[model samples]
Target: MSNIEYQFSEDFAREMDKKDPLAGFRNEFLFPQINGNPAIYFCGNSLGLQPKNTKAYIDKELQNWSELAVDGHFEGEDAWMYIRQKSKPALAEIVGAHTHEVVAMNNLTSNLHFLLVSFFQPKGKRNKIICEAGAFPSDQYALESQVKFHGLNPDEVIVELAPRQGEHTLRTEDIINKIEEVGEELALVMMGGIQYYSGQLFDMKSITEAAHKIDAYCGFDLAHAMGNAPLSLHDWNVDFATWCSYKYLNSGPGNISGIFVHERFADNADLPRFAGWWGHDEGQRFLMEKGFIPMHGADGWQVANSNVLALAAHQASLDLFQKAGIKNLRKKSEILTGYLEFLIEQISGESGVLEIITPRSPSERGCQLSLLIHKGGKAVFDSWYGKGVVGDWRNPNVIRLAPTPMYNSFTDVYQFGRILEQSLAEFA
Candidate 1:
């Protein structure tokens, strides 16, 4: 939390918004409507609201495809063949890597699978993988299947870390301790950059260091962390990582994902990978070489051609990020999330129907706060939704409210607090 004291009033929220530097960005997105009014949207952790410029970006590519036909691949300033390069500058900046270290490519899980093939080399006895216990199911499935693909038993080879009993989130000390305890048997330490359910931003830098101490490779699934949290993958000495664009990146649903490979791996063409023609060196790409001849850095991991249309939509979002600057957005994110946390605590105090499971410290969280419903569960979520508050409901009991700093205002958090208060009154 910041040094500023918080108050629970609509007037205060508006005053904060009035003074907020990023408040004008709220008009850049098209929010969902309910009863002809914009719903208070706090679901950016799941799917970000579309930027108003998205359609124009996508339509430009459609026009190129229609006019140029097959020649679109090599024609125009933004050639379809080199579409991936357009996102590299912003992606590199966002992830804290050199331009060559990052590339926009496959979807999240596919990129994970590709990265695992290169990074998760379990030799002899050093075959165990460590990850958070309740990682998103896609990750769980990917890890399980990867172990199985290697002819190893998932139970014996995959180590799932959990929070201490009765605790909502894992302590960083415990994570580092476990990495040390696992020792030489750990082949890889892969975990979410931010634990999805608890909204806990793990100490990724410390985790990476601990993993490297044991000669283990470290990677992160940044689906929930990428644009929402500040990252320094290269500086942290992280080996690899991947993230979906649809969430904080605000690209369309199921859009292209990206990867970060530390610069040390830039020219290591001998590193085993699943290669496609796109990953071949551009100089001899058209010559149809006999050998794979992988491209430099993260581009070598590509297994297919660029998805031009998707890249265009992704470019639109990345452009906004470049313009706003991630550092600026992060500054606002901490305060906005802090404001949400303060308001939730007030409501939780009065109703006692919910408990905030997200860490109270802004340093330990991003744009999201997760509320554990003690009583009404889905009904409580439904009531908030009925009143035009759009938050995300995870199974059994958690409601995730993410006040994205790019477009969400202090007033949105204030309005959500009012809706939550009313809902808790009815449900409690």
Candidate 2:
């Protein structure tokens, strides 16, 4: 949406909603209530609102378990043993990978640790890792622990790339230059697909190419990018990636996470990984064999059996995603986020109090806009929260608002603007 064309009025928001192709999706989710009224939910980046059909999906699995008992694992079309496979198509579509390249499994941190074991091969003098300076704490801990596990000093082996002085986001050129400067010593290049705080979407394809040119594996932690942004992980040649479903995927809080390994590693059974029975070939799995023959493709990385209930919830959300289509969702997302940005910019005018730290370009961001409050930040956030404006507040001053295309509407953004303006006046 053009800046000049956006207006800060209810009628404008309503008209935009009327024209939105994905507008019906808003009713598919059950919004949280505040004083018997539905909230203006803008926290999908943190935890997406629950889908209405999620209960029915879970109930089916519950019924299966009750009626079939031990037979549940092998019985019916939605068999427990193959439940994870049900999510592959939707997940692959979301992340732009082949079905064989993706799998829903452990939580993000565990999957990160597992993928690091296979990808972060630090040998000889080429034993350095590169990542963003202020990555999410879990990622920081995972990298540090992994480096230590390999008997390397995190300080010397893990190279953190920070934004330039007074800058809120990293430049792609600087990232490429760092990859070149580190050169032979860089063993791996791992970064968040979209920085959780700033909501800056990195140029993954360019980063992957640069890392490959340096003979280093490149991967991403897509906690914020999985469903919020458009990705082509396979075409970009990313070595591996992992993400949680609780956030944009809306599977449920702290639910299953997914991983994407390039097709190049699909048939490479010799790849080092901590394997379990579930990852073994199904034909030989029940034999209780001594040799671990892993299933081909990303399924080989699974360390345990599928989480049936979680997968059921995940499949419910994925089914919605399949029906709505990622392409269509992304289209609505751009305009919804753009509209939110426009409203925020209008509110911030001459106040110098509310500042958007997220990238201005639509191509460089997803649904999220990170607002850096210069004054009375927490108080303003508290006021908004009290008034039923559901947004995430980062430590110190940032307010992250994600107008998700799956459930949020143009009117939601408009309502948030109204609440924000009142809060700023009373607090800031």
Candidate 3:
């Protein structure tokens, strides 16, 4: 119902809001209600607002624990033995993976290490890992630790592709060329599913293909991308990937995360992996045998007992994704984010003070826009936040506006744009 052909105005946004099919979904979230009014929350790209059903899902598990105790693992309603099983179908849909290819497990960083143990096998001249230069601190740390784990020097073995001088994005050709130039020595390429700071959605399919050309593994950190964008981990032929449920997945703060393993390595008997009892064949798990016979799919990578409460929270959120559908969310996302982009440009015209750092094409980005505030720094951003326009600020001078489709309305974007315009004028 959003008409992108016309210029965005307060009336235009209100009209579109009236016609939005997903408009009603906003109320299903448990936004902070101060004085009985929902706060204007525009931070789903960082942490999604909680679903109304989250407590119910968690309560089911809590009841099982209190009443059934150890028996809950096998006998309670929503049996814990198969609690993880019920989640796989919905998660597979979101990531475009086969049910066997995905598993919900430990937190994001832990899953990253588990996947790396299996796929990041560097040897001989193939000892380098390639990633974007300004990746999230956690990812950079993981890559550095992996390099040291392999007894390699971080500087010599880590290949960080950076943005061009005076530019904010890396062109596709630049990425392809980096793979080609370093493919021989590259052990793996792990990138953000959507670059956190700039909101760039890296072309995972192309990157996977390019990396495989030189027999290198490719993976992604989907902290910013999962649930915000449509993904095809299996179809893309990616070796492995991991994502946090806390961000776009809406599983609450520091919830459990997940991983995907392509079926190709699922049956590979010789694939290198760190083994544990939980990953071993369930039938033989209680036997506690010396030999570790792992499961054949992504479940094989899980190393310990799951945190049931977090998994319950994750299922509560993924249920919303299932009901709305990733493709449908993406459909609405294109309109909502495009509307934001259109309005920001309109308000800041000819000012030379604000520039968008993310790509213009919808395919190249996700729900967030990285605004490079020209004349002001974080102090200016603080002023906007003081006015109840909630957004994130990167270190030096960038304001990230993520108009998440599930909860954000055209009206929220319209208002946020107006606030940005007001702040610029007041500060200037």
Candidate 4:
């Protein structure tokens, strides 16, 4: 991974693409139509392109629902009873967690709330939850509501970790320093695994170590990092984490998300969690006992029946993940994103009116680059879109372009760079 042998030339890029194991994967996705051919879609950070098989997978569930009546639960092509279980192993491989440690369940924010119920217990003088400031709005709301639900004021209970003066990204040292300096007052350390806006991949292992040192539980919002980067949640000793699959995992919009509960918590049968019938022991669930006997592991966290359509769509995308190993995807990501960084640099130099807010090092970031438009704002980005270059614009000045390895390629990067260069020229 040191100094990748990048073939920046168009011919070399095509030649490299010819040999890429994942080259054919691009065709498996349902592309957005643009003059018949697909548009240069580089917006996987916002919403992933749908897998072509997603519709077929979802249709199977619909077929069952239409034909099987109530018998679909036990007699369908794939039983609805164990629908979510189909995603566990694929998700485990993606996040480097044990299959027993993962479960496909509610959306990201909902799962965050559920995990917070069990993990974010604040007591005594240790009621503060430390997190990165300006987190994704849903995460922000979840944290605020959870803190306030404990009858604690958010202003006092939620400790925000911010970057230094005039800086856009938080450093590892700064975060660890705050955790250490906070001492025994921190009830939990919950932060984004990769900050959404800045695209910074935080030091999960070190952060967890620091939090545990002070007797605090550590958790992460892996919405932006789960499928984009390599994860070893179990080895890192992360207490709990939640993620959405629609973004980098390419599971389509509003798909059912996944959760990771450490083995320690999994084994803690005495732990407090909000339970439901779906969380009950499968063997006795049909017996409908008066008392709750929850499942042994992460399966115990589910509340209601599985979202079969969404889970099937998730399964469709995760099937691709299982084929293109996370390790392999991440390796290509570093290079693909590196190529993006390189192309963006050329654009910046040529344009002289754009700046990338993301880090220069691939190790410190993921597939995304948050580009700050200089002088020009949303209008410039709109112009780029008009030129058939599709990257997402976030509010006042930032544009987020993610060159995902699953489907994005060197040619796409080149096209985007060329569009950016021309767009800026047109503006000037």
Candidate 5:
């Protein structure tokens, strides 16, 4: 809870929009238009709108490739070979990590598998992994496959923590107790920093500390948390973390992902990993040496050459992130997302059809608010969608609306409220 008094009137929302420091950023994106106007795009938790400058960034690279051909890897303004290096500083700033600690690499699930290969070290009694019950499907698959690869049964080695009966989110105390209970058997604690379905932001620092106290490695799938929340991966002493760039980062869909490995394990030559030539030492990389001399930091986790065009798109969004400063963006996010929550409450007033599953505290969530729709389910969501309120609907009955600070505004959230009221009146 914040001190700001939220009101339901459109005038109040417009006033907030007028005062927003980040309001100019909304114009920087190419929105999905509705009836000649931009749609109420509260879906950054799924896919962010393209930055208006994305085309220029990508075109520069295409030009460089055409002119330089094989020499482009060394000669361009952002050389193909060093393209990942150029994006590292901004990425590090976004995630609160050192320059060498973070790298833009493969997609989310691929990075998860790669990180697990090195970090999910199960030995003797320490063979179990803990994750949330309804973690994103890809994470579930990665964890299960990793466990099976070790000749362990996922059912026996994977401990899924779920919310208590009738509860919407996991209690931090319960999570701490579970970590302590698992004690010697816990090999890794892997979960989302911000849960994808319920939009609950887990206490990552506390969770990391708890796991460490029990001698267990801790990591996060930060796909939903990356550009939406403030992270201190290095300060938190998180073991390793990975995230996709397409969501709140405003990178295009299926764009490159990012990874963070704490400084302690980054330079450890003895750490077992699945390596490739790109992860080789840059100087010796061209030698094609038989031995894989891994690079000293997160780059060592890379399995192939940089995805040039994908990186161009990613870098364009990261430039905005650098200019906007994550701390400032987070401050505005709290207010805008809070406004959305307040509006939802107003629309659902005394109505039993919809209930917010996301936490009420501003500190315990990102930009997204997940609504559990009890009646009309998909039809209610469809009505809102038809009205151009572009939120994401999950299975059974969850509609997630995220007013991303980088490009979303108070007026956008306000318009979503208007359409939501109409949707409920007609369907629920």
Candidate 6:
């Protein structure tokens, strides 16, 4: 990954694409058109493009519902009763968890709250929570409410680790040191697997081990990491985790979220949780009994029955992941993103027109590069938008671009480089 071989030419981009083993995957997604041609879409960090098969997947479920109604639960080709099970294996593979430890249910924040009810148990003096500063707004709200739920002040009970002075990303050593600094008071250590804005990928294995050393539970909000980066949640001994499928997973907006709980908690029925009938033991669920006998594994945390249509849409993307493999996707991501980085540097030259806030090392980031534009600001971003470049803007100054491996190409990166050069000349 040192000094990647890149050229700012369409022929070079096309030749590189021809060498790509995963190039065929670009055809599987539908992209938005700009001026009678596909626009350069580098905003996958915010929302992934829809898979072409997604419509067919949802249609099958809709057909079953039309003909069978309630009987669709027991009757269809993909029975609604076992719809979650169908997605389990594929989802488990993406997150590197055992089948029973992964379940698709609820949205990201809701799943976070449900997981906190069990993992965020604050006792006596060990009531503090550790997280990165400037976490996604939903996570910030969830942490604030969870702390307040236990009758503790968030300012005192929550320890937010910030980058020292002028740095844009958190150092791994700093994160681990903060965990030790909090020591006995630290009840839980939670962070985004990859920060949404800076796009730094944290070392989950190291973080989890450090938390365990301090006798605290550890988990991650994998919203930006799940399909974008390779993860071994179970092997990392992560206590609990959750992720939404819309961004990197390419599921529709507000689609189902997945959760992972280690096998140690698989049969610990005494673990307190907010339960619904779907979470109860399947055999006894219909008996309508008074006492709640939770199901074993992550399924025990589910609060409602499966959403067949949404799961169907999710399964379509999972199928592609199964076919393409996370390791392979990550391999290409490094090259694609590195090319974007190289082109950006070449465009800015030594004038310092843009600064990449994300880590320079490929190992420390996914496909995203968050650029701090020095001068043109939002007007420059709007000019790029006019030219059909689709990178997202993060208030004030930063513009984030993600050249996703699944649907984006080397050609997209090349076009982006050319358009950016034009925009900088015009705006700067």
How do the predictions measure up, each by TM-score?
0.98, 0.98, 0.97, 0.96, 0.98, 0.98
Write candidate 4's Cα lDDT for 3-87 as tens digits.
Answer: 5566447775777678778888898887686656677888888899999998899888899999997898898668898877788
Q: Where's the lowest-lDDT run of ten residues in candidate 1? A: 343-352
Report every candidate's CA lDDT. Answer: 0.91, 0.93, 0.86, 0.86, 0.91, 0.92
lDDT of 6 at 56: 96
| Model 6 TM | 0.98
lDDT of 3 by residue, 1-428 (tens): 24457455889888988988888888778887534556567788889889999999999889989999999888966777667888899989989999999999988898898788888888899988889989999999998998899898999988888998988987778988999998688889999989999989999999999999999999999999989888999999998989988888889998988999999888775788887777888888888779888887988887887778888899888888888888989998988889888888888887777789999888999898998888767877788777777788888888888888888898888887777788768756
Off by over 4 Å in 1: none
Winner by lDDT? 2
**TM value for model 5:** 0.98
Output the lDDT of residue 406, model 2: 94
> In every candidate, how many clashes are there?
0, 0, 0, 0, 0, 0
lDDT measured at residue 416 in model 5 versus the true structure, 0 to 100: 83
Instruction: Write model 2 residue lDDT over 287-383, tens digit each, in one string.
Output: 9979988788999999899999999899889999999999999988999899998888888686877899999998999999999988886887888
lDDT of 4: 0.86
RMSDs, each prediction?
A: 1.0, 1.1, 1.6, 1.6, 1.1, 1.1
Between candidates 3 and 6, which one is better according to lDDT? Answer: 6
TM-score of 1: 0.98
Candidate 6 lDDT trough over 10 residues, lowest sum:
1-10
Error of 5 at 37 (Å): 3.2
Say which prediction, candidate 5 or candidate 6, comes out ahead on lDDT.
6
